[model samples]
Target: MTSGCFFHEPIRLPIDLNEQSDTLKGTDLIRVSKFYKDSKDGRFMSFLHDDARTLYDVFRKGAKESNNGPCLGWREGPNKPYQWLNYNEALLRAKNFGSGLISVGLAAGPHTLVGLYSQNCPEWILTEQACYTYSLVVVPLYDTLGPDACAFIINQAEINVVVCEDEKKCNLLLDKAPRCLRKLIVIKDTRPTTNQRAKNRGVEILRFEDVERLGAQRNHVELPPKVTDLCTICYTSGTTGNPKGVMLTHQNVVAAISAVILQLSEYKPTYKDTMISFLPLAHMLERCCENAMYLVGGSVGFYSGDIKKLSDDMKALKPTVMPAVPRLLNRMYDKVQTELQRSCMKRILFNMALRAKEGEIKKSIVRNNSTWDKLVFRKIQESLGGRLRLMLIGSAPLAGNVLTFARCALGCLVVEGYGQTECSAPVTLTIQGDYIPEHVGPPVACCCVKLVDVPEMEYYAINNQGEVCVRGTNVFVGYYKDLEKTAEVIDEQGWHHTGDVGMWLPNGSLKIIDRKKHTFKLSQGEYIVPEKIENIYIRSQYVAQVFVHGESLKSCVVGIVVPDVDVVKCWASENGIPGTLSVLCNNPEVKRLILDDMLAWGKDAGLKSFEQVKDIYLHPDPFSIQNGLLTPTLKAKRPQLRAYFKPQIEDLYQQLD
Candidate 1:
């Protein structure tokens, strides 16, 4: 099973961790499964998986139990059919890949750093597993990154071996990278055009198959990875400066997965379920999600490189769970709602269904498959392969209205979590049936959370808003090679300053408010959270994307808005307006309509007087990852946005009414 791809294998865990019995120890926290031990310390909660010390151990145990289980699914092309690989076969492949690394004189040690530059795919996982097997630190680079970014990370992390998707990515670094790089491994079978150049430079070129064959023939043995051993140096998506290499150890990842499992005790996701992987593996949250799937013996299907084909992929896989970010979820919501708005009757019935959903929420009910579920909700479900039941949203703050709309209209149980790459991802997650639109639930079993006062920003724990600080086993070691940066975030008390502001709800859930340190003051001496302001304006269907800016001492706000294309097109057809999306965005009347709608949204959000977007400039092109306006996870890069739109913003200030 480990040698090659095969089909018809059912996912099976060595044993159902959920079926293992547990006894509640008279406290709010419980070690609900036999997989872990309950915390006896003074901390509020804890879960120690005594046996699962390292990531390799976790997968090794699962692979032994689910040797022949179908583990991974991917496609050849957008229109191509899907393919499968079993667990035993994947492990063997990874072992061979690891052995191949050793044979090349690239023994895994403290200085060993391997770079993986590719989109999410089965090979990425295989390479990562190989890294784990050899105890080599994996350094992941975003596939969308430019040449400079690629070169910067490779040099900064001192990557000696690099694995890429194709010749294109490999070429970006081959010439510019440091001479320390020894090997270029391509996932594709085709020979790289830069192969000769790499060889001339004394850098070896190995196809993925070559690595596997080397390891299999070499009879590689898996090194026992220690809990404290460095596993990966995950770089943060630098919306501000150069990407920082986050040093995450095997213990950090183990603690994170344990906490995630503790939070999801009720769902008990196991080998029987399936998940769709569309997010980049460079992002720690998505990486963590894939790891959790592998540990639970659940199957994961990789989405094609073209994200526009996700709906088609969904239909083919019929995945049970989907891990997403706010941008993706919001886009899905927008597309579905736009179609529903096509007919007046359809829109009316959708509103009626929303009201019924609100009533069920107010009454604390678990819907026993209602009439609306069959009529409208089921269609949205079918469009997404008809089997998606749970969605895990993270990487950015989700709007309350969007959350409500997803549960009410899309008919999926949506759960939002809050964390960053520094925290190894899920610090807190919403429970399955007990979800609050505003709150992101409590800290996970292994984490201890607190909100510290930030008087400079007028945020205080008493007012229910302060900088969120976390201390736990899941917390990362520190910023790689930057002790000064490490000391700034982690202190003598061992708390990792999250930089994000949050508060505790009456129900003890955590509600993330805004960034504490990055905010600037507006004219009237009001400190404004730019992301919050932008999110509010985006709630209006008229505005697809927005970036809010306020000058020091300026009472009013100016926004750069990207009008929703579908909504604008519909409006143009109905109002006798004639223009493409770009032309309409610059149209005075359309601009007025969008600005008015955004102003109304700000008002509805109960924003301060200074928070109102008094003037707006429309850009036809949306904020995209490619343009550097947005991060890979779709979070706006505020500094970059301001610099790019400086001229428009300056004119807006002068023309302010």
Candidate 2:
């Protein structure tokens, strides 16, 4: 199951059962393998009828196979315990809540409140699956989301029941009680202080123990779900507009998981695999993977709450697999470089390692690593949970240098993935052996990719880089209640146009350059792909967040840069530089240092003159949801950000002369 080659099955599902015109469903699909014909090839090789039902069955089978897999929730101190839950256990817990048309609310961390007229846990194989299956739509709310946005999603979801992590989280919903919400159920290791008024307002709040109590009351409980049941309603983080409530059937999760498992089977043969789940569970990436763990009975551990504590959590969990966002890997690369720069010996060792890595160093100059692990790289590996096997980065682009460095330094492979919530999760992911930084990788098993030209795009690919489109069972039924937007994305042929601009690499891999909609024109009429340009700047240690855009009448590309905190701190100390972030950005010395380095990097990357950053303005702030500079996924919100920093950009442009 572990190799660079992929198996292709040409089976297509029936269209009659598919309610959506552009989707495949039920009875028409079968499994065919390019690698092997038998299921004993150390992979999950069972085929489904191309229906949601079959998909769910396969998922359960995978879960049953990986019975000892753990669901590690988060690291506690130095001992990160791996918590295992069997498929029967998860199913019973989900099903025991039983047949209720309940709405679910999610309070990400503690300190949130659940209102009355609101809310809702656990145990026993039958009860676990039962509770897990209820028509409880889990609405995930982040700590940073504004109250109004939070209220909108809750009301839109009509969430009658909520699952809060702690008391503080319960309070947020409690304040909003008397509105659309009905009940609150908090999932905590222990109970929290009760709010009398909140409870009386038609909101019945209960602790995890209460859930256990409810499970005890179920006599002669129902059997396992038929797989097509509406298990959860996951909402997308609205970047362009209001969030859409995506109703994912048990089938959707199962199908997506099967595709991923089959795709990774080559590199990972056993169901006893382990994964670190740090991405928001609300996200399809984590949700789908979590269910995938169920199929394989794999272990999944939640890292410490903050990114700052991720390294420590990693070591504690010692996960065999990890899923991350590009930002995380990029930051790790920055950290390592900054740390290396701090010491002469470490820097020399790192450069030597890199040279050896690229096979550019002579045998005489390359130092042996027999003692190197303890001397140089053990801390980095330990920070990543030591047992690290493979790292997967999704939701955004990971710089090539970042990926390459981690592979060489950490002695682990970093897999880059591409997908959207609508596809249930993954569509394409990098596999072992044939990974390239420029390409996001190939289509996942059972998925098909096609490239279609955007009539308006003229500067993209040789054959014209088309908008990347995908079709597979992994595709969601459609956006719930948003047919127009759904249609705009998925066409009559069932191919989902991924808004991403990409072309086939010489090796047939897909290379995503930028968002098709995000590409803009300069005053000289020259087209600029900002994402490509920004990726170059972002890979540099001195730059963090970057945005490149043009101004009126001028074909200039300007940037709002957030310098790497660690790199700047180290660089400033060594250079005897001092000032606030803003002052340091404008300091002649700092600007000269960054500009010189960036110019060289850009030149080496072979960027077009127009695509190159003409000037960069240092921004004291990081682009985040709170600041409105970036979308929830950390992508720059172009229009708003460009206008907001118009003055600073103008100043930078003036200085460029």
- Cα deviation at 331, candidate 2, in Å, is 2.3
Q: Write model 2 residue lDDT over 1-657, tens digit each, in one string.
A: 211122222112212111111112221121112222232121322233343253235445655565534333444455555454555555444443443212233332111222221111112122224334432233456554455556777776555555566676777666665376766655653243455756666777666546545654643333334455555555666666676766666566666666666655544435656677667765788767666665555656665566676676666666767777876776677668757766998799877756554441111111113245446666777777666656677887766767766665555545677888877787676655443465676566546666677766663333737777776656666765677978888889777887887766554456777677877777788777777787787667688778877754676787778887767867888888887777787787887777677778888899877777777777767888887776666667788787888898888778866
The candidate that achieves the highest lDDT relative to the unseen native structure: 1
Q: Model 2 residue 614 lDDT?
A: 75
- What TM-score does model 1 achieve against the real structure? 0.90
Off by over 4 Å in 1: 1-48, 77-81, 200-202, 357-369, 409-412, 577-586
Give each model a TM-score.
Answer: 0.90, 0.81
Q: In candidate 1, what are the lDDT values of residues 1-657, reduced to their tens digit?
A: 110111122222223322322323554322222333453342423223565677777766556546668888998876676788888888888888888887877776545888998988999998888888889888998756666777888888777889888887777777687767878888875454478877878877888888789778887667757778988898886677777789998888877877776666645456767889998888888888878777777888999878888988988887887888887767877777778767999899888887887666544343415677677777776767776656788888777877877776555556788888998898777765553587777666666677789998987876767889887778888998889989999999888999998876655567888887568887678887888888788789888788889878677789999888887899889999998998887789998899888888788889877888888999989888889998755678888999999999999998984
Extract clashing residue pairs from model 1: 1-89, 2-88, 2-89, 523-553, 523-554
Candidate 2 CA-lDDT value:
0.59
For every model shown, the clashing-pair count is: 5, 72
Of candidate 1, the 10-residue stretch with the lowest lDDT total is 1-10
Please identify model 2 stretches exceeding 4 Å from their true place: 1-63, 66-132, 135-137, 175-178, 189-194, 200-202, 223-229, 355-376, 459-464, 569-578, 585-589, 650-657
